[model samples]
Target: MTMRQHAVSDDFLRPDSINAFTDALRGAKYNVDAVLERLGEAGQEGLTRNQTMPALDRLGDATDAQADLIRLFPLQQIVPRSRLAAFLDVPALIEAGVLGAIGREGIHADIDVRPYGFTDAAGEWSGWVAADPIPGMDSIVTRTRPNYVLGVSPASTSLAQLTVPDRVGSALDLGAGCGVQSLHLARHADTVTLTDINPRALDMARLTLALNGLDLDVRAGSFYEPVAHDSFDLIVTNPPYVMSPPTDAADRLVYREGGFAGDGLVRHVVREGASHLA
Candidate 1:
């Protein structure tokens, strides 16, 4: 098969495959702390700044399975098949579109699967979040596509920290990007509904849930549309609040640009979202 010529599809989401992937990741110790441990203090600092070279340097000589995973994922570097297959389901991940084959002996991740862990009233939680290949991590794209689903950002981290920890019957993540906020809600809410307008974002959200060995409702449509008749005890939104100049071009990212002028999108989300809460 032409492994390098890949087209990401829903075929890679097989439940059994995803379960195996999750197992491999945990077995490889791929988590928030793994990155810090692999890339010492200085390397961690550089990675935090989006400067991957330092961390990449730290992993240059490391040949363990975990190190190979760190390179294939976090550093976006290609890894030898034999090494990664030691801990990961290479064929399953490749079929799922999570990992793509490069040359005969090398493989690389097609998306950014980040280790996301946070502390809340529910307790300590750790999960994997998937999104489009980061531009900086991959040499393929100079800019992001319109539907580019961003991974974790300062906004998501901050919003996660500020969320109410009380348990609820049902929860809604209004503008679920890669479902980061939804992961948090799932901890406290009996059921969590993730809704997004972008198609790719919806796919990433599902992948994020699957990687964490969790599942919840993930729908597509503008805010409140997917859950029109549904009501939730708690509702949270980590929306696109960039408030950039109005533009309908392909350069406008769906994850951050609300496509409305000024604060109009924010107002719309807040005003319309209030009605969906129980």
Candidate 2:
């Protein structure tokens, strides 16, 4: 499988460019409710299974800025430049590293952008999560993307929702991917720190928070290495938890594979977590 090269965090953080890009999304109502309403029930259901054609078919011949983005983002289709420019800053998108020029054909997304929203007792939180597309996504032809940093997923969102929303002085989101958990933590914690083994994931996390007009501390390293000297009032993690059949270390994936034997990663985190919590 030929893996597609993705635009990193630095590529998308231009001040003016990002400002324009987000403004356009807001003007177009490109949030979860709007996109879901546009896709309809059937299309939304198909999307969960990684099917894009249903959504694409439902959005046939639409000519609005939100429609353009819905096609370009979730459907992963190359869109007419003119139509996209109506609702998005095409040049800004290119500068921000989300849109790639396809010569004279059109523009394509270099990363996945999807609407994400959740409601807690405090009310509702919503925003888009941008990251490397999963390899087997219907719109993505590749079979595997080893360095892929995931966007909001079922497992990740489940963990976020299950987390206790107790107010705290500080919180740590270990193995933070695309900053989803950190975003949730920001609503309750006075300060939030996100750490990840993959630097690219850290980059995406920063962009995700920045796009949503939130700020936090981001560090790079495995587990507690970056925050060894520090402590937090709360700690949350949705760690890599896949178990491989063979004992071979090479069989593990960085995102899912914990370097240790069965459940070792979680155990290690648990053992070390006490020292870092107040």
What are the models' TM-scores? 0.91, 0.91
**Model 1, stretches more than 4 Å misplaced?**
1-11, 138-141
> Please, what is the whole-model Cα lDDT of each candidate in the order they appear?
0.80, 0.81
The local lDDT score (0 to 100) that residue 3 gets in candidate 2 is 30
Q: In terms of TM-score, how similar is model 2 to the real structure?
A: 0.91
Query: CA shift at 68, candidate 1, in angstroms?
Result: 0.7
